[model samples]
Target: MVIFMLVKDVMKKPITVKDNDDLTEVIKLFREKRISGAPVLNDDGELVGIISESDIIKTLTTHDEDLNLILPSPLDLIELPLKTAIKIEEFKEDLKKALKTKVKDVMTKDVVVAKPDMTINDAAKLMVEHKIKRLPVVDEDGKLIGIITRGDIIEALV
Candidate 1:
């Protein structure tokens, strides 16, 4: 089952945003579409950065005091089981950031993008090395064509 699977078998068409797009618009898209992140593009549709809920949360919390009260920071919450603690800490960190933050500020600039033709194993290896959950599939010109998530990998493996 694994040998027969590849990234092309499960990748999703990527939704993207421009650098000039306001953070409000990004947040709206994420909420309405139930997406966590998107590829940031320029006028030419070149892949600029990747933005996610984590990015948006940073914009709201890090730069705004009032927004801070809107969500409880995990850092301020009581301790939890070890297994759940890891996920909780990550969530708390995202909640403590501000909205004025730019994609450049929060995005992983040294991104581990993938080619559509790459095998699933190749993508999985990159994911492990970079500690990322998704890969922005790019064309020869480095424009985003699709995206593959760890969920996609699990699906492929099964």
Candidate 2:
């Protein structure tokens, strides 16, 4: 009989971020580690949220303007120079806001998590159902211990 894998058996030690961490620092971590996302923890070491690349992109794109300038479209083609200038200005403002923002401001607070004893099959199902790439593994006390990703599951299966 094939024994099913458990989350703890496949999960890796998580790279986590504090709830109050600066978004700039988090971005640096993402680049340096080459990871797309991480689990967010509170001062008490409880998993409170998850931050992903999509979250960062969403935060940066939350501007008041329509921001849907399609280049080469008839209207934009007629005012190329003016449109270019306006886009550059908007880019500067958005960059400033992104740099100044905090992780807590953009993190998804309602994080879905996995238990150490959960079957890998169940964990994979959870990830698919939630449309998430990873799940923070928590112990009975609700403290983050490890994280399981789609890659981890794939590696185990193969």
Candidate 3:
């Protein structure tokens, strides 16, 4: 028998970032939590935007023309020799500037969300349609409550 499940049944408590949070702090949070993205919330705890690893990488690579030349593509940095690509001091200074940059500055503002009552299958279809890996689950009032990931649906099926 196939069972339909609601988002609340499989969603995990959201790991959120504040709009005013420093990019450096956000990056640290992502690293520590091993998350690729997070919902950006305002002072009232309302979801305003979303930030992902791609955004951070874009910010780092595009901020300076020198940096952009060194790491033309996001993956190029991994293959390029770091010492030849950028000086340690320059990289550190860039990181410091990045740390001061607010999450709101780099977050994707036009966000797609899902209600807690939405079915897992429906959510999965929405994700596929939008080409997203996850969806933030919101309450009737539109407050972020949890997040459902692609992994969640697969786990539910198992």
Best by TM-score: 2
Worst 10 residues of 1 by lDDT: 61-70
Deviation of model 1 at 49, angstroms: 0.8
Global lDDT of each candidate: 0.74, 0.88, 0.86
Q: Identify the leading candidate in terms of lDDT.
A: 2
Put down candidate 1 lDDT per residue, 18-63, tens digits, no spaces: 7767676777788888788888887887887888776666556533
What are the RMSD figures for all models against the true structure? Answer: 10.1, 3.4, 6.8
Cα error, residue 8 of model 3, in Å, equals 1.2
lDDT of 2 by residue, 1-91 (tens): 1139899999999999998988888889999998999999888887889999899888777544544554567876678778678888988
Residues 1-158, model 3: lDDT tens digits: 22578999999999999999998899899999999999999998889999998888888873444444533676765645774445666878877787799899999998889998888989999999988888999999888999998988899997
User: Which structure is stronger by TM-score: 1 or 2?
Assistant: 2
Ranking by TM-score: 2, 3, 1
* Poorest lDDT segment (10 consecutive residues) of candidate 2: 62-71
What total of clashing residue pairs does each candidate reach?
A: 11, 0, 0
List where candidate 1 sits over 4 angstroms from the true fold.
63-105
Error of 1 at 7 (Å): 1.6
